[model samples]
Target: MIVGPAQQLAYVAADVARLAAAFVRESVGAAAAASTKSTPTDVVTHTDFESERLIRHELMVRCPGSTIVGEEFDDLAGKNSVGWIVDPIDGTVNFLYDLPVVSVSIAATINGQVVAGAVADILRGEVFDATLGGGARRDGEAISASSVSELGQSLVGTGFSYESTVRARQADRLVHLLPQCRDIRCMGSAALNLCWVGCGRLDAYFEKDLKPYDYAAGALIAAEARAMVDLPERNGEQFTIAAAPAIYDQLRGLVA
Candidate 1:
């Protein structure tokens, strides 16, 4: 009855993603009853907590002995080294507004290193997933990062923080970056944005003030698809950058 992390990636991740997608689909619109988190712009809803509860329950039943870290609740202790990072709704604002850009993300880590992960684009019904050494995929088909070699030709993706002050600084940085790349997009969901880079929909992506659950799944998927990924860290604040090898350095330099 024991399920390895790889099996969890290959099977459980997708299963949970579908479950999450169903929950999102069923709860869209005013019924979500959204409420503000840090700012009026930062939203959450009953669906977010419910989705995480469902996912955590499933993970506990299928992959027992694994820790569960979720955005909506405190960490759940486990007896083994495996850990499940969950972002039940990665773009809650988008979900609140009935935008089709939200997603559900889950990742499995062992000894603090992510080994498997999945991101479910709820509105699109696409699932992006990967395991360590196993290539990334979207809806079961293999995917890869773009090969665009120059920043001027690359379409980059990014997100702003909910804090207005932080956003002011981020906008200031973007002022320098906007004119350098082919273009930039703010997709709202960091997880999906990273998956977009993995699938070649975007050549690069960067953002500040993210949580571990925000990029855990998508980072693994991007890296597995041959994209270079740097998760946010504590140099006074957290930030993340993921890009195709060809344009990573240029993009990083501009953002830095």
Candidate 2:
């Protein structure tokens, strides 16, 4: 493992995520769609900008000159070796619509590797965080993935693409996956879905075409929870997966 101040980075991630989550909680009702990106269905809200701004400023202050790669803003390079990956509002549509599934996620990287991360479920006021080899925790209590070994009995979570054409392809794949698994849940927020997997609320999770910020933080938490994780690189398409060790290969066979 890369030796770094993982615990300290995790703390920083949690602080920024908490700050961003608070902003989202307060701005949800008043926030409206400022514009659409990629497609009409893919929307962005004023709250998103504000949340990311808050996260960026706080993170920079905490870890001065840290590079920030955020959803709504251009990447910032700085003198520090630390880097941050942030998603201000993981569930933009859900937030504007007053749905409680929204989340704020941030990951801290050192030497180009993710060392720590945090995902805050804003409406629930719960924060999940973890560091490399430190295990996962929700609200400071250790959490782990489910022990379920049977694919037919596992609860799976997933998300679709913003592009309808890609979604159509994803749906076709799901037609096969749903029958093989106990059930499927598409929560509209990849980060939240991944965190749920870490806490055992979800047995496994997989999604296609996710951006880095969407899965970065939550993936670390899930992996630290003893979940079998396969995080994709910045290839043209990123198909991410996290499952209990027992059913990992089984679930991946279906989704892959």
Candidate 3:
């Protein structure tokens, strides 16, 4: 079965989301185990690991030849040119606290470029999806970035670094940009923040210390919905700034 990239990606994404939601529901009665990967503030749970494993297993079954790059998984599944990127539990800390803003994100990349993506807002039952040239959608309904042309009228979102040392720099950057905007929100989930931006719920978003999986799917979804995405200025930096085209220039200037 030679499925198209976009179709295949969509299938994998939907499958992952379904499995992720089940994992979250199952964990409600499970024991809370605090585990650290690199630092204390950066937390991982049994759910995160279990969810990633489920997502991986489903992907392999659906697309046998496709490669898999996931946060919870260490090595790539295969070296196929086309692959899937997965973030089983995007907001692990939020999920741990039983917050309703977490999500599962998945993207299909061909030759290192995203071709399709989806982010499932677990608590809201919203699934934002997009294909390379196909328009973005929220649960089958089309979505687009906000039309706000002025920064004073725009509502923006951003995320903080888990590492304390880098978090100060993010806070300092926010200080210079906040006064110029209408308001700012610090959402714990990077993928959901960007998804909301795509659906016209947020005018702009920026963040630091994000991995490829965190923004890969959301970036494509926003871009397909007519939003602009910008990468961090410094090399090896994990910063990202995504916004509606109307205020992209103005907001970019504020952050830059």
In order, the Cα lDDT scores of the candidates are: 0.88, 0.90, 0.82
TM-score of each: 0.94, 0.96, 0.92
User: What lDDT is obtained when candidate 1 is compared to the true structure?
Assistant: 0.88
Residue 211 Cα positional deviation in candidate 1, in Å, after optimal superposition: 0.5
Clashing pairs in 1: 232-239
**RMSD vs true structure, all candidates:** 2.2, 2.2, 2.3
Tell me the tens digit of each residue's lDDT in model 2 across 175-238: 9999999999988889988888888999999999888899999999999999988877843347
Model 3, residue 55: distance off in Å is 0.3
* Per-residue C-alpha lDDT of model 3 across residues 1-256, encoded as one tens digit per residue: 7767686677668667866766676675453655887677888888888888888888777777778889876856575778888898888887777777788998888877789988888778778888899878898889999989888889999988778888888788888888889999987888888888898889999887788889888988888889988764343456688898989988877765
Residue 195's C-alpha lDDT in candidate 1?
Answer: 97
Best by lDDT: 2
Model with the higher lDDT, candidate 1 or 3: 1
Between prediction 1 and prediction 2, the one with superior lDDT is: 2
Highest TM-score among the candidates is held by which one?
Answer: 2
